[model samples]
Target: MRNIPTRHTAGRTIGGAVAALSLITLTACGGDSGSESTGAAEKLGENEGEVSILAWPGYVEDGSTDPEVDWVSGFEKETGCQVTSKVYGTSDEAFNLAKSGEYDVVAASGDLTLRMIAAGQAAEVNTDLIPNYEGIYDFLKDREWNTVDEKNYGIPHGYGANLLMYNTKDVTPAPTSWKAVFEDAPKHKGQVTAYDSPIYIADAAVYLMAHQPDLGIENPYSLDEKQLAAAVDLLKAQRTSVGEYWSDYTKTQASFETGDTVVGTTWQVIANLIDPKKAPVEAILPSEGATGWNDTWMISSKSKSPNCAYAWLNHISDPEVNAQATEYFGEAPNSDKACEFASEGHCETFHAGDEEYAKKIWFWNTPINDCLDGRTDVECTDYQDWTKAWAEIKG
Candidate 1:
């Protein structure tokens, strides 16, 4: 949901190491090397008897959240790898916490994955080692966001789009574009809300890309200073109408139900949690496209329990486990077979196999000086710049 800042923002480090990596039945294409532990473990050595995980809420459940929702217990019984978990609210917090070397694995959203790679916090994943890897959706594998130069980093967990949601009664005419929250923001005045993170800047950039073609913004995350300034300006104006900015998932839903927020950005999960009886609402992906996230379970490069980490990866990727996690988290699962394990029509609800539908959503990616949109001529503002700009906008 957020990323990159000043304090620990060190320059990228280069390393060399090819590990014996395989995905499902694929042959090992790389060899193990020291100094750089390829994100994969060479063999399923003995389970370390325990593993620690850093994940988003609802990803790793031992039924503590809901006794009926415990999947971690089954994994532990089968593999003898006890699990200890810490949940993070934002991608930025996950990225920072992963650096502390306390967790063996992390469920990283797309926005923070590459930054983790650049910082050497993530290892190259060898998919062959994962027994359930073959069942993953073909569309999620070997993609630029989770792979580097043809090597996989980790297994994709799930994905969903950030949709426009509004009070069905208060907001007339059923809004269909992000303009309701940007250009027409004043209309909602003090009743509008937005995701509270620097990443929300990309929402403005998405709006500008459609309305201001002269800005030449190809990718929301690849904005240069001029383009970023334009986005920031738009946000500064919209800030005037915003009732609150949300990062805490529960707070977002509570604000909507209480009528403090009438319109703004939201995830399908939050929309589901809101009681329609209390506040009738509707959500949709606007014509201008929307920002979204694709999360992956990446093992920590410094993990002392590689075997247990790999075991956890495989266990979570299993169709049943995948189904439990994705459904609870309110997103599409990464494994194609997970649908069979989901509730009736759950897969259809998220458009799990509709590649065409996915094309309309721009998944989050960390902003860097080297433009991801492929423009070398103009130097783009990095995440640190976004952090500084965000502070100014919030002020």
Candidate 2:
């Protein structure tokens, strides 16, 4: 019942409704708030009996997907908050669904969280209500995507980086950089695979950041039109050698196992799933670093069960539960303590709580016109532009 990470889909337009949402200046710590006047709950009320949740698949389990993978039941049992959950495939889908105001809580990736905030769908969270928040890694807290104007919008969930994965048997002269999938891709023509998302463009930008310093690409998410064009050009060139553009976990695993794909961008989870006997593979955060995701759990502005929603957040952040959830999803736990409850060697495998290694990743952030890298001289292209460019790259 393992599932792939929920990612944005290419060519899916961010319609006028979403595009028209107010644009907020994204800052490293706390900057300004352009979002609607929605404040965090001052205190929790009695249990609301039931709380609805919208999240990525495998995030909220009740022993339904797999009898052993049940996290919701315990929350319901302990808090008296009956948990009703819905799963979303992509960030766009989650954004639209969250706008309905039906679900009390929604688990969103970095790309979707800001949009929810701008649209007045997400409420600023009073992290004080959730004691477990203190145990979370400081690096994962109060980021631009999940926090605005010094307000907390949600709790950090799990995070993992997009890595350079290559078959040891087919890819010789071990790849220490992403050049294997960008510049040197043609060498393994028709055998290289890349992530099937516009966000994948950031992977190329990461490479340029290290190898093509002349481009001045400060942040992968904040790309000007020219910078985006450069990334598009690199991806377009890599496209010729790409055997398949993959988002589905099974397909990519199969390709690597059968030798159809020898090199590409992959999640550590996908690399772990591959059978070493059939396809010896290694996944690494290349020297150039990588694009990754740090999902957040935010409450809805119109939530009917605010107390229950807050309770759920606290329950999930417990070291034991956090360990179960993150390990099951194959990402780094948010805290060092959670590592203790996780399977032996799990933290080492994912590098949980390693701040130095964490710094190496440019966690996915929504691209906006106001450059996230603090460049005011030029406007950066937004996700909409990236979507259109992705279509062009694929074609």
Which residue runs does candidate 1 get wrong by more than 4 Å?
1-39
Go through the candidates in order and give each one's C-alpha lDDT. 0.80, 0.82
Best by the TM-score measure: 1
> Quick one: best lDDT, which candidate?
2
Tell me the tens digit of each residue's lDDT in model 2 across 227-308.
Answer: 9999999999999999999877678999999999999988888888899999999998888778888989999888889999
Model 2: lDDT of residue 71? 90
What is candidate 1's TM-score against the reference?
Answer: 0.90
**Ten-residue segment with the worst summed lDDT in candidate 2?**
2-11
Clashing pairs in 1: 18-31, 22-127, 22-128, 23-127, 23-128, 24-128, 39-123, 39-124
Superposed by TM-score, candidate 2 places the C-alpha of residue 54 at a distance from the truth, in angstroms, of: 2.0
**Deviation (Å) of 199 in candidate 2:** 1.5
Measured over all alpha carbons after superposition, the RMSD of each candidate to the real structure, in angstroms, is 7.4, 6.5
Error of 2 at 200 (Å): 1.5
